[model samples]
Target: MMALAVDLALALVAAAAALSFWRLLIGPSAPDRILALDTLYINTIALLILLGLRLDSALYFEAALLIAVIGFVGTLALCKYLLRGDIIE
Candidate 1:
């Protein structure tokens, strides 16, 4: 059933988010932590989209889109910092 599929998807995404959080907390390197943060935000967007599907509403989709954009920009900034030692010159 669709409901069962949605539940499964939600569980998988939640598990991924949890693992990413663990990495973020205890990663051995800065790049690892940054990668974990990026994964976490991506997982969050996935959750939001799954929720929208489950609830049969388009409302959560907008929030998911916003999160995606913000996450992308944040990742870029972090990468820039890692490369240049500063986010802005």
Candidate 2:
């Protein structure tokens, strides 16, 4: 059924998010942490989309869009800092 599929998707995405969080916390290097953060954001996006599908709400989609924008900016800043030792050049 559609409901069962949605539930399964949610569970899988949630598990992926948890693993990404673990990597973010325990990463041994800055680049590793950054990569983990990126993965976490991606997983967050997936979770948001799944929630939207389950709830049948447009609000969740908007929130997911906003998070995607912020996550992208944050990742760019982190990468810039890593490359240049400063985000503001």
Candidate 3:
């Protein structure tokens, strides 16, 4: 059933989100943490999209898009800082 499939997908995405969070917390280096953070952002977006599908609403999808944009910018800033010791100039 489609409902069952959506439920399974939601569970899996939630598990992935948890693992990403754990990595974000326990990463051994700054770059590792940054990668984990990016992964977390992606997992968060997946979770949101899955939730939207499960709930049959468009709001979650929009929120996911917003998070994706913000997360991307944040990741770029973090990487830039790591590479140059500063985000700007």
Candidate 4:
């Protein structure tokens, strides 16, 4: 039952990641693309943590945490650039 649950959860995350990828490819606006990338990052992090749980390893969890932090920082930078028209002025 636990394995089945994990499979189901990962399947859902995979679906979310696919949808976000499509959005990133076809989004009309820059912000839309950025948002889609943000969603993809979140899904990736979740998937990594789930895989860690299934494999009984904490390294994947740490990698997921790092990804989350990097993703958040990148998103913030993108949003700032979009809003202010400058990234490092």
Candidate 5:
């Protein structure tokens, strides 16, 4: 059934989110933390869109788009800082 498939997808997304959180919390290096954060952001967007699909609405999709953009920007800034010691110079 479609519902069962959707539920399974949701569970997988949640599990990935949890794993991302764990990596973010206890990563062994700066790049590892950054990678975890990046993964978590992407997973969050996926979950949002999945939830929107499950609910048959477009609201969460917009928020997910916003999060996707912002998360990319955030990671870019962090990477810039890691590389150059400043996000704005």
Candidate 6:
């Protein structure tokens, strides 16, 4: 059933989120942490989309889009900082 599939997807996404969080916490280097953070953001977006599908709402999708935009900017800033020692040159 579609409902069962959605439920399974939600669970998998949640597990992925948890793993990313763990990596964020335990990463040995700054770049590793940044990558984990990016992964977390992606997982968060996936979770939001899945939740929207499960709940049949538009709000979660909008929130996911917002998070995606913000996450992208944040990731860029982090990478820039890592490369140049400063976000703004």
Backbone atom clashes (below 3 Å) for every candidate: 0, 0, 0, 0, 0, 0
Model 6, span 1-89: residue lDDT tens: 99999999999999999999999999989999999999999999999988888999989988999999999999999999989999989
Candidate 6, which segments miss by more than 4 Å at Cα? Answer: none
**Model 4 Cα lDDT, one tens digit per residue, 4-84:** 888899999999999999999999899999999999999999999899888878899789889999999999999999999
**Model 5 segments more than 4 A misplaced:** none
TM-score of each: 0.93, 0.94, 0.94, 0.93, 0.94, 0.95
Q: Give the runs in model 2 whose Cα sits over 4 Å from its true position.
A: none
Candidate closer to the true structure by TM-score (higher is better), 3 or 5 = 5
**In candidate 3, how many clashes are counted?**
0
* Tens digit per residue, CA lDDT, model 1, 1-89: 99999999999999999999999999999999999999999999999999999999999989999999999999999989999999988
Worst 10 residues of 5 by lDDT: 1-10
Better of 2 and 6 by TM-score: 6
The residue-by-residue lDDT of candidate 5 on 31-88, one tens digit each, is 8999999999999998998898888899998899899999999999999999999999
Q: Which is better, 1 or 5, measured by lDDT?
A: 1
lDDT for each of the candidates? Answer: 0.95, 0.91, 0.90, 0.94, 0.93, 0.93
Query: What local lDDT does model 5 show for residue 45?
Result: 94
lDDT of 2 by residue, 29-85 (tens): 998999999899889889898888898887888888888999899999999998999
lDDT of 3 by residue, 30-63 (tens): 9999999899899989988888888889999889
Which residue runs of candidate 4 sit more than 4 Å off their true CA positions? none
After aligning candidate 4 to the native by TM-score, how far in Å is the CA of 75 from where it should be?
A: 0.5
**Scored by Cα lDDT, where does model 6 land?**
0.93
